[model samples]
Target: MSALLDEIFDVAGSVVLVTGAGSGIGRTIAETLAACGATVIGADRDEDRLGEIKDTQGVEPVHLDVADAGAVDNVVNSIVENHGRLDVVFANAGIARGGGLTTPQGTIDAFDLTAWHELLDVNVHGVVHTVRAAARPMKRQASGSIVVTASTAGLRADPLVSYSYVVAKAGVVNLVRQAALDLARWQVRVNAIAPGPFKTNIGGGGPIDPAVEARWGSTVALGRMGETRELRGLALLLASNASSFMTGCVYPVDGGALLQSLSLDPAE
Candidate 1:
């Protein structure tokens, strides 16, 4: 058993950058990090949301769009230039585009291509650009932790979801491994979070899709969607010295989703 002090996630002297910190799980992560004593700089495309985070939570807010390559670099430069040191970065920005190959008629080519590009632009390239921009300063500082949000679709494609979403999320998983190895020399750690069905705005916000609600009601062992706050402990673990030796690993937070083998592996 570890002592309370030893197990505590320490960030008292560190600064953390959380992209997409305007709402949902991202907002939860930023607020939790701040509550744990880290000076959090929350970045999001929604200036109004950023304002809310600032006014309500007192977190330092910066407007940023991770999908914009230029903004990725500029936001990172400004943060490092201002703070003089960045200790943690959560590349949690993402979007979901849903459509099956069997969509009921109408511009099939446009629909498929747009879905692919939009998901990739926001999911894969978002992480890539964010990592690239943050890495230089983190390397110079000689310490940092990066957490990217992947998905259960990343581990295995779900016919229930669009192909583009799975492909992009899977890319994030591998990107974390590659980045971890690349940054090890600089004392920076890179890892990812593969979240299962959680109550968030990923799949068209509002109430859960009736179909998904019915399925999770039975299909999931937990028997319902997860609350965003449940991820706070894991988020802080990945962002702090508590996980000093962990890297290049895709930590799945699914409620037993990955453990079930549904005759889906490529091998017979």
Candidate 2:
């Protein structure tokens, strides 16, 4: 077993591109891969954030909005041109905005046009454009891994977060499955991570409400919110040869939160 992991999970020399690599899970993934010996290219719309990350971990940084069709393709092209090939593409860029019909201030309400567009643009269209760009090269290479970041809300509806957040994440999950099937013949693996409430900035900006977070933790079988590092092993597993036979599957790393019926404010 130990020998198998040593051989199968070796990421050395692989070229990986991680979108939204400026912060949170994307950042974690990039740094982890670098430490594990993969050549990582990190992309983000925030130039300064990208620069900061670049300075720290020696990642090649490219600035572009994932929603922009031309920019998306350009980023992919840049990676191929510079690295010769991209072995892993993690489309983990996403945003969250919460609102119900009654809350005119909510992100999905008609009044929140900018927020709604931002959510759809970054969360849905971004993933679409990104994966579309990656598919071709991965197909030609006949081997690659694509991991998408979805949410627990994607599996079921709840009032804990914004409506659009749930919808966008759900769409991402389906996209992973569909892409997985389409790329199977090419030996390109596509999978999604249905991460539960982690100490990240997606739904909650930075600091989660203590009470709300406590409530969510209570509902989880693990009795705590997940650490970002806990996901590193899982990410490497799916991206490496360990999961050569796994694709078109959504792995929920939610500490079993999806198993509980109790509703906690997911936004926290």
Top candidate (lDDT): 2
Candidate 1, residue 146: lDDT: 94
Candidate 1 lDDT by residue in tens digits, 133-195? 889898998889999999887998564456787789888999999999999999999999888
Question: What C-alpha lDDT values do all the predictions have?
Answer: 0.81, 0.85
Error of 2 at 141 (Å): 0.8
Q: What is the TM-score of each candidate against the true structure?
A: 0.89, 0.91
Instruction: Give one digit per residue, the lDDT tens place, for model 2 in 30-72.
Output: 8888887888988988887787797755477889799998999
TM-score of 2: 0.91
Off by over 4 Å in 2: 1-4, 100-111, 264-268
Instruction: Give the range where candidate 1 is weakest over 10 consecutive residues by summed lDDT.
Output: 259-268
**Residue 254 in model 1: lDDT:** 76
